[model samples]
Every structure is written in structure tokens, then in C-alpha cells.
Target: MVKYFSNDVDIRTTWDLVVSAFWQRYPNPFSGHVLTEDVVFREVTADQRLLSRRLLTKTNRMPRWAEFLFPANLSRSVYIVEDSIVNLVTKSLTTYTWNLNHTTLMSVKERCVFQESEGRPSLTRLRREAWISSGVYGFSRPIQEFGLARFKSNQVKAMKGLEFALSNLQGLRLTVAERRHGVSPASKTQ
Candidate 1:
């Protein structure tokens, strides 16, 4: 079965600030599960779009009752690959991420779009679309269901993390014309 989730965040900042925060959202208070993130690749297209690829490692606990249902190798850690593109002309950012490991057990795909709100030009909008699925034994159906529930629970925390990161970044930009790529305050080791 395929389970889905959706949410949106509105921040009183330009889309640029929102986009900048996306690159530095990890290491925030609410995302302690994230262990590390590395930029695998980054480049600017001829049309001036920013494209980036990243790898992230995270850890999460399995419900105590379901511990025995998974293999011993099913530790808490999960690795994922993320790809993002920012279009200057459209003033929008699009991201796609999926699990690199644990595909046999399940697959999680997430898509996010950030843009300047049409109604509120001074506000940026973040939209998320994610789904989970598994093909393994009949066990995957239940596993996916459990994951969806956990995802829903964690969704709010994730948005708060983003807001915190964005706030830190927004404070750094003295002006909209000045490009600020400074590292997020929470981007460093806690």
C-alpha cells in the first residue's frame, strides 16, 4: 500500500531566504535523529538554476513491540539521497528525496516545493508531498502503515525545525539584494 502526507509552511520572508534555509536545515534542535549530511554534487545550470545532490544519514528507533519483526541488521540508521533544483527565473525550488538503503524493505519518496506566495508576496510557501511503500513480504504493508503514522507524528517537528533554521538565516541577511549564504547557527554541531 502507498501512504501519503502533505503539509505547507508560510514564512514571512522572501523566497530566497526560504530557499537558503533549505540547504542548511539539518542539525536543528528537532532533528536530532539526523546524524550527518554531505553534499555529493552541486552545480549551476546555463540558465542559472542551482542543482544540488546530497546524502544524509539518520537514526530512529523501532517500536519496542515490533523489534523482533525485523532483521537484526535493521538498526536505527537510514541513509537517503536528496536532489534539489532552484529556478531563479521561476523563483521556485523543487526537491526530490528517496531512501538509498532499505529499499527491499520499503521506499520513501518526498517532494518539496518552495515559492513566493502569490497572495502574500512577502511570504514564502513550502509545500511537501511524500509517500511510503513496500513490496517485501506481506510484512511491508504493515510496516508502511506504521511508518506513515510515525511520519505524521514527526511532521510537525520537522516543520518547526525548518522554521527555526529559517529564522536564523533570515536574521543574517541584512538586505534582500545581498546574497547571504552564511552557515545556519544550528548548522553546526550541538
Candidate 2:
């Protein structure tokens, strides 16, 4: 069994700042399960596009229903691999992430796109798509259903985490254009 999830939101910020925030979002209060993040690869293309690969560690996030399937001694930390590309010319950023660990029980694949809002320049349109499945388990189909249900619940909390990061960005008194430059107005003075 396979399940899907989606989200649409308007972030009152430019793509640059949104992309920057994406790289810095894991440490927020709403995402306490996220333990560490590391950039495994990054490069700027000749056309000024940015490509990056990152690995993230999430701790103590296994769902209660699925804990018994996995061994008690199995490390609580799960690793996720993310790859993203920023199209500078089009003012958009797209990303894909999937579990690098715990592949046997379940796998969740997610995609996110940030684009300059056509109707509102000050806002960026964010879209998310996710697919989940459970394979190789004794009760694979039922496990997938259980995993999907939990994933949908987690998605809300995760979006709130991103929103929290945006609120943090907004708290620093950054102007619309200031966000594009990757700095708040007050930070420029020092």
C-alpha cells in the first residue's frame, strides 16, 4: 500500500530567504526530534543554480505503534537524505528527501517547491508532496496503512515547524528586499 500527502502555503518571504530558512529549519522548537544536519554536497552551476545534498539525523521519532516491529536496541536516530536545486533564473527552489535508514519497515519520500508568488511578490508559494510505503514487513500492507496515518499527522507538526522558522525570520524585522539579500536590516549596520 502507498499513501500520499500534500500541503500548500504562502510564506510572506522571498525565495532566497525561504531557501535559506530551509537550510536552517531543523533546529526550531517545533522540531525537537531533529538532532543534527550536515551538508554532504553543494555546488553552484554555470547558470547560477544551486544544487545541494544534505543528511539529517532525527532522534526518538519512531511512532508508538511501530516501535515493536523494530528492535528495542535499534538506534532511535533516523537518517534522512535530502537533495535540492535552486533555479536562480526562475526564482524557485525544489527539494526531495527520503529516509536513508530504517528502509525495511517503511520509507517516506517528500518533495517541496518554493516559488515567487505570481500574485504577490512579497510572498513565496510553498507546495509539498509526500509518498509513504512499508515493504518487507510481516504485515506489510497493514504496516503501510499505519505508517501513512502517522505520517499525515506528523506533516502538520512539520509544517508548523517551518512556520515557526518563518516567524523567527519575521521577528528580526527584515524587509521584503532584505530577505532576498539573506540578512535582516539591523544586521547590515554591524
Task: Put down candidate 1 lDDT per residue, 32-86, tens digits, no spaces.
Answer: 8889999999999999999999999988687776777777777678898999999
Q: Per-candidate TM vs. native?
A: 0.85, 0.82
Regions of model 2 farther than 4 Å from truth: 174-190
Candidate 1: pairs in clash:
none
Name the regions of candidate 1 deviating beyond 4 angstroms. Answer: 174-190
28 in model 2: Cα distance from truth in Å?
1.0
lDDT digits (tens) for residues 1-190 of candidate 2: 6778887988887777777777667777778778888999999999999999999888746667667667888887889998999998898999999998777777889998899999787899989898888776567777777767767767777878877777777665457667888877779899
State the displacement of the C-alpha of residue 84, model 2, in Å, after optimal TM-score superposition. 0.9
Q: What is the lDDT of residue 85 in candidate 1?
A: 94
TM-score of predicted structure 1: 0.85
